[model samples]
Target: MIKGYKTQIMDYYEKIRYHERKALQERKDNIKREHPEILDLENEIGRLSIKLSMDILRHGNADDVVSKTREAITDLRVQKAELLVAYGYGQDYLSMHYQCSKCNDTGYIGTKRCSCFDRYLVKLYYKSSELAESIKTNNFNTFNLDFYSPRSDGSEKFSPRDNIEQILSYIKNDYIPNFKNHSVNMLFYGDPGTGKTFMTQCIAKELLDKGFLVIYKTSDELNKDLRTITFDNDKALEESLINCDLLIIDDLGAEQITDFSVTNFFTFLNKKLIKNKKMLISTNLLLSDLTKSYTERITSRLFGNFRLQKFYTEDIRIQKKSLRQNRFSEKTILNQ
Candidate 1:
């Protein structure tokens, strides 16, 4: 999906190997100068290792002889290690280092891509998607329950604070910890500025931090991406949407409701649901109006596959702006 990203990662691995080999050579030169005896022992170890390989190839040699040769080489290696430590150098001082020892700084382990490579790709995705900066301010640690009222209204069973506390508990304690095990998707519907998008962002940050490939797009942004997939035939972008760990679509009804938009929306959601890729959708539209708002096929897939939750609270944007104004007033009074 990203331009020249594979080449960039390959270059990173090449640089790692180059620097490590250079460092190893400097360490070897130091050893050769100060501890020539240790260097001589290392040469002997190399010679014996070559002999062991040759003897293993020689079918004429018995197993006992090969075993004896390996034991002697091991003794010399241990002795050399002891001398190096005694002289204040680490035992591995002459060895080349790897950033990711599993893949030895290469993006792949054998033929398959390594977990470290996935992390790098995720980093690039987050950086490009603007999620890295967004999560810095909107994560779980920055979330505040004080904005929600503790007093219950007659329309709901509990206070906004109580309901949100329950929702947050389920998301943080249960859902997030068992994200991999559970195949459930989520639907967050609420009044605008009632913390629907904020909670969705919180989940995004949590999952992304755990190394999940999370793609966040507003409904309008997704509409444009779908257009690109249709017009440009971007297979990588399509694969990313269909195969990511989680796809978060915010403001479901904000896009222009054309026939094309409705059709593409249903198709994308249906594909993800069928493939078992998790998704979280947040919308300002009422849950009851969903049938009226969307096509029958879209609503059917949503109600069947998604675990729907309704957010309830006064506008958090208003509350936060008010809080900021109060802080400014307090600061001014203090200065006076």
Candidate 2:
């Protein structure tokens, strides 16, 4: 999973570095404005720190001067920390912060990858292969409305094609264009092979191309993550799930049903919804059937918070397979 994402991981580290650098500068500016005396002490410490290095390298400079310069810088730093604490700030308020202090948000310690990078790779591994290859052909450009018949079979008011067109229109004009400001959580519910997951992948690729972090996990994988978060205390997995631009949970009813799964899942789902994070759920279960699998409270939240979209079409995989077989038969007859 990490094989194709080396550049992306490095780019993430670069963003962290840029953010930390800018934040340090902002803190410095605030300190200078609020307390000039402390800022002056900080400046003197910086000068002596540089002078200590120069004295150590100078040929005629004695060791005594270097040691005294080092001591003076240390004493000034202690005073600065005391002042920051006295002024209702952390002792290390003026210091820079790093997401990964071991690597200083660089993703590597010297030449080797850091533990944080490995954790990122683990999260990436949960992404389904169906999604990984969906970008090449399953996007909006390749979505074929022709596969859905235009004629209504009396199942509902509109034909499959008309229904799908309405969904795609909302996706294109309303959802993707104004993703940030106009985010709406969606529940894509349907039986198997109804193109629910494919459309979800299409949206995933679209947002990812627009520079958003989209995390995809099947129900099983999400349960596994929740278990790890509950027992193993995996903060990285929890953070990724909560903070991704859009989280797509495919096949939501397939995970093993247990007390732990139900408890943790409801808690996780509520947290994300309360935070107003964008999410997409594709479930084979109907809205009414969800009560059999999950608590009524969970179903109510899903129905209340998420915009429901029902998918109904012939099994696309089977349709494609039959078409391929018909083509092969025609080719054989022509050859014979």
Candidate 3:
């Protein structure tokens, strides 16, 4: 992954260089066609620059010659800019352009990586995660409130749509803005196909777009990696899980439970809370079920730290499938 990231950064630099060269050549060609004398002036500047370099190399202590050459080069640059302006071009027309002037199209400023480079790495990490393609379509804008029923059931006062809307509003207004300062943990627990995972993905997409480092993994995948730490001595996945700005674990109850999983889950939750890192977990199990499966200590940490939101919606996937079938039937009838 590191190698791939490096290759991607280098590719971006190459593209910048390629476009810069192309634009410079086009400008030079236009100048040569319209004002041929400008080319002669450019050549004179280039020759003087070469001469200055040679003179400095030959007589290192020749302060007079070096000073004269420096003044001559400065004069040539002023002349070049004036000529460009006189020719109906910008004064900086011949200057080398860069996409990012801070790093001059390179991914680093000295030894540290630029913010742009960090964003690229975050994008790469998002792409490398599971269900990455869904993130493009599953953000807040694409989330449909229509899929959730607004009518209250006999047992519940608030409808699914109202509950979900409140949750979304809270996330947008409070959670995301204060994410860096607060360790806001969320637990989405409900039935399958009730948009639990969808909501988590929407949160992840929003945070990722805000340039936060979000590491998303399924509970099964996370457990498999955590298990490897004991046998294979692999710490890469563990480090990422704990250190990411936002760690999202999907389908929390679907993973195989074990002694190690229970112990590590407690440790992971405690550590993330201590570090003030945010976490979002989606699961199909209820609070009681979770308590029965995991220990009271594990459940206590989760209930104590995380804001639990129970999804009370019908199966949206089934509704979508039905809608698709209806569309297909309508198209078939139209064709007939």
* Candidate number of the best lDDT: 1
Clashing pairs in 1: none
lDDT of each prediction vs. the true structure?
A: 0.88, 0.84, 0.83
Q: Rank the models by TM-score, top first.
A: 1, 3, 2
Tell me the deviation in Å of residue 59 in model 2: 26
> For residues 200-276, could you state the per-residue lDDT of candidate 1 as single tens digits?
88999999889898989888988988988888998777887888899999999888888898898898888898889
lDDT of 3: 0.83
Give me candidate 2's TM-score against the actual structure: 0.66
Off by over 4 Å in 3: 1-3, 29-40, 43-62, 122-132, 135-161, 177-183, 208-214, 225-245, 260-275, 291-301, 314-336
TM-score for each of the candidates: 0.80, 0.66, 0.74
Pick by TM-score: 2 or 3, better one: 3
TM-score of 1: 0.80
Where does model 1 exceed 4 Å of error? 1-4, 40-90, 127-129, 321-336
Cα deviation at 274, candidate 3, in Å, is 4.8
In model 1, the worst 10-residue window by lDDT is: 1-10
Q: What's the distance in Å from true for residue 334, model 3? A: 16
Q: Could you tell me the lDDT of residue 320 within candidate 3? A: 95
